[model samples]
Target: MTVIDNTHQRLLPAPAADVGRLLDRIGRPGDPLWPSPTWQPMRLDRPLSVGATGGHGPVRYHVSDYRPGRLVEFTFDPRIGLTGTHTFEVIDHGDDACVLRHRLVATPSAHMRPLWPALIGPCHDTVLEHLLDNAEHAVTGTVTDPVRYPWQARLDVRLFSVQVNATSVPQNALLLEAALPPAAGPRSDLADAYAARVPPGVTTDPQAWADAIFGNPPPAVTALFRLRNALVTPFGIERGDRSAFDTISRTDRELLLGTDAGHLDFRASILVEPDDDGVTVTLSTHAVAHHRTGRLYLALVRLFHPPVVRAMLRRAAAAAVRPRPVTPPGLPTTTPLR
Candidate 1:
């Protein structure tokens, strides 16, 4: 019970329920293990296991209490020389806003505490910073750039382009083509919702299939989904989740939100499946509007249209699966979610 270390304050943009629901979705009972999350089964009423293997040796953890969304605590075996608790709490900020808090409580064995400064102190700040970013996205629908805790908040602005395509292997045939603007246009915010029935392996790659598509996408995608709704000014739209367009990069981009007086966010996700003959990949993309009036500005940008976006992505997918037969001037060929 000695407080060897603690991170007292972590704030998130979402309300309590949203954050809680998300935690349940990722670490709930029956959910498969995700690498090595700090929380363990002992913390929940459901069954759970704890252990990590990597550059470091194995570390085991014990869970103590589970209150789904409200709180989860963990105590390590004395052999591990560490005990800790993590709590997620929601508080009312105003009629329109809520605060989510994440806290860490830790005690290290005599041998580990003094070494904490050299061993774990540097990372504690980073872990808390990451938690704040994740929590904000979970509730607010935007992925804010990493910021320092309790001080010096900066703003982040960005633009994204996403494309999706479908093709059949062996036959090297193109199936369907689509994107946000509906046909060939770009900047179309329309959600490009499609269904495909294809053969397995014809679509998803081995390990990537389960990770990028089949599973629930990572938190960034969820944040994007939430932020997409709050854009009131420029009013924007999404074709698919941001995860579907992993090729897109955020570097060397114009800023979207500022620290002093701005919003923070970005997100993406995609899902793919194979059927009898081919695979179907669903892509969803979203953008955030900054100023209260920016929503209309963005929605008007819809001039780019969605159909055109889909066509381009489809062509790309076709090319990947099967080379398009080139008849001098004309030829065609063939893609997923987070």
Candidate 2:
């Protein structure tokens, strides 16, 4: 059995009430304190009053107490095992300054004991710091030293972060004539659309979404690119025509890219559609095999392409929202919680 008392606090250059006001919106639409997109937004079944039930990510808890503009406490569900409670409190510093704090006191269950230190603990500590960073920035407009998780913590966070599943591409996303279909035919030998919702914690603008989706090539992608070059060079085929993520066109709301390789012409469509909540970014792949080699390549890649595309989209969404100290030329590096 292991019991832990953990706490994180930040002094902000705003009145205590001002900082405390953020506590009231903890699980609300415009949460200013809980770092999100990078982390799950805290959600309650109801409002933030006592008895409101919910938790962020996989954590489950119910509000045991609430004090508007001062403090709030959440009691972890006993089913999950809890000792004390998790709380957010505000303390007065001066008329123009205050302190905001989050504390968790818990005794890990036998199942969680080992996992907590290795996985949960670091992520928890980092998330708390990120929350406090958000608090400081919300009240003070800047975060000089934002929380940065070590590689292990970052990996744990990604492995445990919100999961957005892939789905059939929305018709709206496919409507971008410039992004899909064969230039000469209604479709191609390999025309498929897979999509995933852009996370709420990321910007809804199509251009920003495009950058998130294609800017960083995941290691898997880069490795495959190298392997592809090696496989194609032996046959005197132009292997890097796609250059991994080639862009044919870009606009404020959509992007078109792909390649006309030696044996196949492949085009991909990444579409961003904004709605009330956030946006959905759809990735659609189209390929026309010009020869048996192209057909064979498609047949082999198809088995893994769906998962690969889904992973690429999921990775991009996570990258767009990783917490960092806010330094601005435009918006804060993080998208505002919606």
TM-score against native, each model:
0.35, 0.80
- Candidate 1, residues 235-257, lDDT tens digits: the string is 33333333433332221211011
**What's the TM for model 1?**
0.35
Cα lDDT, all candidates: 0.38, 0.72
Instruction: Report the Cα lDDT for residue 68, model 1.
Output: 68
lDDT of 2: 0.72
Model 2 TM-score (2 dp): 0.80
lDDT of 1: 0.38
Clashes of 1: 64
Clashes of 2: 0
lDDT of 2 by residue, 224-328 (tens): 767877887665566673354566777666677776777788777777775533456777777788888777777877887877777778878767666666644
Model 2: weakest 10-residue lDDT segment is: 329-338
Best by lDDT: 2
